[model samples]
Structures are given as structure tokens and as C-alpha cells.
Target: MPGVADGQGLGPVLTVPNLISFTRLLGVPLFLYLFLATDATGWAIAVLAVGGLSDWVDGFAARRLKQVSRLGELLDPLADRLYILATLIALTVKDVVPWWFTIALLGREAVMVLCLVVLRILGHGPPPVHYVGKTATAILLMGFPMMLLARFSEAARPWALPSGWALLWWGIVLYWVAAVLYFIQAGIHVRAGRAAAAGAS
Candidate 1:
């Protein structure tokens, strides 16, 4: 495993691995446009699946090709959030997924991002992706598209709704756990930073 220290000069951005992430970001608007403009839920789901697969592809390529970029890491999550948030909002407008659930999920994501941004401004880069956070994202990404499909397709309705809801609940749980872990991790780093500053003074 390559630590930040091990790869001082190696750039992770602008590589094949990161190109996949850029593709995912590009998919975000496409998915949103498809869902918003068309009644083609099946097509939307298929496109969303392609976007999701791009997520996996980028990460795998990064590891295999050693092209992991800091920008890619940030871009990947942003793309995921944009895609999921748009779909959830669209569904809510159509009276499928509840507004409350969408709000809750989006709120968590927003707060975490704000926290990371603040930390970065304070001279600490965004924290590494915790496993729990990654898992939560995967669940949410996979679940939301299915949930959207169920909203418009009767054939996908039976299992997709329940399964999507189940995945949603699990994702929520994992997100909260990850949030707690992030808080603890941030607190420790904050204290350490403060102590170091005091020592320097």
C-alpha cells in the first residue's frame, strides 16, 4: 500500500484511472437530464448503472495502474453525490421517495463536505476515505438508482422498492457511523495540531 509519504512526486490525477472518474462526473448531468426530461426510467437506471460501474472501474484502475490522484478522490465522491442527490430530488418531486429521507441523506453529505472543506482551509487536507464511508456510498449509489427505477416501472416495483429502502436504511446507518468516526478522527487531529502549534510557540 502506498502512503502519502511513499508517493511524494507521483501524480494521481490526469491519468487513465482518473479519466474514469471524469467520466462519472460527466454521467451525473446525463443521468439527471435523462430522468428529468424523459419518462424512461429503465434507460435512466441503465445509465446510472454505467455511472456506478465507472466508479468501480476508476478505483480499480487507480490501484492497478498506480494512477491515483488526489483530485480523482475528491471528484469521485462529488460525482456520486451529485448523481444520487439529483435522482432523489427527481423522485421526491414525482412522489416516490419521501422528501424526509432525501433531505436527511443530503444533509449528512453536505455537513460532512462542509467539515472537510473547513478542515482543508485550516491547512489539513481532506481525511482519507474511511472504509465505512466508502461502503455507505456504495450502498447509497446502488440503492438510489434502483429506487428511482421502482418509482416508474411496475416490473421493477416488487423487489426494487423494498430492496432499495433496505439499502437506504443500511446506508444511513453506515453513514452515521462513518460520521462519528470522522468526528473522532478530526477531533484527534485538531488536538494534535493545536498541541503542535503550542509547542512551536
Candidate 2:
């Protein structure tokens, strides 16, 4: 079918959204290098800005252009996670964020992964992207670059550092809340799956 894929989401593989996602995925490593290796502030900011902009662009294109796909849905979150991972790694190496913070963030993601595996075993699909989760991601993404600027540029320290730290912590708290919501979502799906199976039998 031209319009469906394995009874999942959209069908196309080469969608503008998917391509943008792949590009963002690739940009993760490049962003890491620029931030951690070269410390090229201008280029790093450019890449981060473009990547952030592309995030919005891809989603809009997916809906307006009708190019959404299962691959895209998967890639989009994966890219967001990679970006978060990359930011965490680079900042953690730089001692920009505390170890506990990293652990907390990664821990939530790890639990989500486990929950997803359980859902799959129960023949359910991935959790829907919650608005809370998206807001958390956006806050963190925006905060990271500001934190970098705060670390690297003395001129921007007074404002950027405070704002960045504020946003970052807010994002972290809300992210955990989103994680809790996802767990509830998983539980609902699990019960539904079990009920469906029992009915069928």
C-alpha cells in the first residue's frame, strides 16, 4: 500500500521529516565534536541552532507535507534522545553538570526503555510522545546551548548561566514527571492488551 506500512503509522521511508531526523542524528556527533573537541563556539552554536530549527521544521513538514512514517516517528524520538545523550556526555565530561544529574536523566530514559520492552512483549507499541515530554526536551535543548555559552563566554555568564541552570533544572523535574506519565500509559496499555487477549480466547 502506498499509504501504510505494516499497519503502523505512515509508509514513506524517504520523507522530508525522516531525512531531517537522520540529519539531526548525524549532527549529534558533529555537535559533540564542536563543543567538546574544538570548542568552536560559533560553529557549535550554528549547528545547535540549525538542529533545533530543523526539529520544528520536520514535524511541521511531516503533517503539512503528509510525509509522516513509522520510521520517522521512531527516528524523531531517537534523535531527541541522542541529542540529549550527546549534550549530557559533553557537559558531563566538561564537568558542567553534576554526576547525579546525569544519572537522574539517564535513569529516567533507562526506565522508559525497560517499560517499552515490556510493552512490546505484551504486543503493544511505543509510547506516544507526550506534550510534557516535548516541553521538557525543548527546555533542555534551549538551556544546553545557553549553559555552553555561560561556560565558554565570560560576557554571557551573568545572564546565560543563571537562565540556563534554571531552565535545565526545570526541564529535569518535568522530564521525570513525564516519565511517571509514561509509566501510567504503559500500565494502561498492558491492561488493555491482557483484556483483548482474554476476550479473543
Candidate 3:
């Protein structure tokens, strides 16, 4: 979906897009249960597929239906993060991906959290999601399922393993790049805010 201008009034909450986002969020626990408790790799993959598809669908529905909301904005990214976290945990537990891989991705998220906190304390909201961040997220989402397939499906291993790693590495690099960009933007905002305060004082 195209980016709507900031401060465009957040539309209604009970919308098609929000419903789709909520459904995607609901799949997270089911995915975790399937992958970890039951070892249902195939079913887990299916759930992931649905979650990914719904991710796009929600954004499209928001734009097409003119139903974008603050809640939907919050829910959409929250669902994405939860799914990524859930997948990382499951993969790490299965030893499909190295612990360092998880740590690196998680570290970027930690930096992002710090940026958000600093900005919030300075009386600013988070910066808009960068395109690089969105691209990195989409790549990681694609890569995770391919990795699961590579581990479980002998036939897919040849293609999936190499491609999955490539995507994962690329995603990680871009994810940090986006984080740095966000951090820089946050610094600028903080300085401006403080300057305004000092001038007033």
C-alpha cells in the first residue's frame, strides 16, 4: 500500500484491514504451538504463509477500502514483529539457525526500541517506517519459511538453503541500515526539541 501522509486522520478501527491484521496476530501462537509443541513443521509453514499473505492483504485493504486506522497501523507492525520473533525462537530451538543469527537480528530490534524510547521522551513519536525497513522485513519473512522448508523437505534443500541464507543475510544488513537511519532521524528530532525548549526557557 502507498504511504499515507502523516497526520491524515486515523480512520475507523473496526475495518477490513484491522480485522486481517488481527487474524494474522492470532496465528502467531498457533504457529508456535504447531512448530514447538507438536513438531508440525508443515502446518506451521502453512500458518506462516497465511500470516505473510494477510500482511500484504491488510495493507492493500486499508488503502483500497479507505479504512486505515491508528490501531491498524499499530497492529500491522506488531503482528510482523511477533511473527518474526516467534519464528526466530522456533528456529533457534530446532537448531535450524545459529544463535548468533537470532542475536544479531534481535540486537537491531533492541537498538530500534532505544531509538523509540528516546524519541518518546523528547515528545516525539517514532519516525515513519522507512522503505529499507519494509523491504528488509519482507525479505526476512520470505526467508524464514524457505529455511523451514529447507530443513524439513529434502527436495527443497538444494534451492532453499542457499537462497534462504542469502535472503536472511541481506535482510539483516538492510535491517541495521534502516535502524541507523532511524537513529539518525531520532537524534535530529531530539536536538530540535531540546533547542526549542532551551529557546523558550
List the candidates' TM-scores in order.
Answer: 0.86, 0.90, 0.88
| TM-score for candidate 2, residues paired by index | 0.90
RMSD of each: 3.8, 2.6, 3.9
Colliding pairs, model 2: none
Model 1, position 96: C-alpha lDDT score: 72
Shift in Å, residue 8, candidate 2: 10
Candidate 1 positional error at 7, Å: 15
Cα miss at 31, model 3 (Å)? 0.5
Order of candidate numbers by TM-score, starting with the best:
2, 3, 1
Candidate achieving higher TM-score, 2 or 3:
2
In candidate 1, list every pair of residues with a backbone clash.
12-68, 12-69
lDDT of 3 by residue, 54-122 (tens): 667888888887777887878888898998888898899999899999999999889888878877776
Best by lDDT: 3
Clashes (N, CA, C under 3 Å) per candidate: 2, 0, 0
Off by over 4 Å in 3: 1-11, 192-201
Ranking by lDDT: 3, 2, 1
